[model samples]
Target: MVELSKARGSYVDPAPARVTVETWARDWLRSQSQLKPTTLVGYESALSKHIIPRWGRRSLSDIGYAEIQHWISDLSKNLAPQTVRNIYAVFSLVFSFAVRDGRLVRNPAEGIQLPRRIKAKRGYLTHAQVHRLADECGDSRTLVLFLAYTGLRWGEAAARRQRQSIPALRSLFMLSV
Candidate 1:
């Protein structure tokens, strides 16, 4: 009698207990057509690499806060803090959707303490430092100076264009995007 009230009101049908985490997650992903490309990729990566591997075979109703906390603790030992948070973001998103979809009464992924992301102290390049770096860069002097002044953050995988940047910077330098 108590279980009847907790069922998805529909996705449960005759057997709510049989509905695995993977099952609910797949449905949730299908309903999330509005996600951006990068967000979708991250969500999929979280599922395939972490969430699904740990919980895919388990039923939706079987999950709870303590187990998730332990799993997160395990993840924190290996991954960067930000990466763990990103994974938990995707995990929480799925369980939140399940609650909305009526598969659960509340999100199990909520209230768990995630790792903190500590931002690196931003270092400024002095005028002399910039000049020295530009001199060392030879023909790429213009590129070095332009990058030093701009606060735009770039990662290792970020694309850099050598020939187009000079002209592009000249035109776009005045406007802050």
Candidate 2:
């Protein structure tokens, strides 16, 4: 019992280090004020559909590279490449927060291999097709023609106001036959 008495002065209680993944994840989600509404919704979806169901109850210290790699491999068999990547990104973010808050020494989600997303081939419209599209659009013929000719994205076209006129738009419409 003499050794116990000798060590008593040096035996300071270590800081509480047993935070569950769910607790940290909730806190992390709550703290993300800068994220856009759509992005926030996506993050929540990923957590609920994938990460939280698998690892939410585990402590941060209990997770490791092997466990994460295995989980990702299992996910890849059924989920799409992009979906798996999105879910992994959410998991990585929670671990990153843990590291920043001193709950973890490093992010376990880092450096894991993920399936590459395949790009779909884009189809280009011919002049005839553009004219046909404009004709089919009826009342929005000008808008359709403008979009087809200029290749403006849907959001960009939707945001354009008539009051803020582009001088080049008028010139572009004078198509020489």
Query: Which candidate number would show the highest lDDT if scored against the true structure?
Result: 2
lDDT of 2 at 8: 70
**Which lDDT value does model 1 have at 13?**
39
Which candidate ranks first by TM-score, i.e. highest? 2
Q: How far off is residue 164 in model 2, in Å?
A: 6.3
lDDT of each: 0.78, 0.81
Query: What clash pairs does model 1 have?
Result: 8-102
Tens-digit lDDT string for candidate 1 (11-36): 34336545888887877787888989
Model 2, range 109-170, lDDT digits (tens) per residue?
A: 89989988979899988888888887788776667778887788879988987656444565
**RMSD in Å for model 2:** 5.5
- Residue clash pairs of candidate 2: none
Q: TM-score of every model?
A: 0.73, 0.80
Which regions of candidate 1 deviate over 4 angstroms?
1-14, 138-143, 150-177
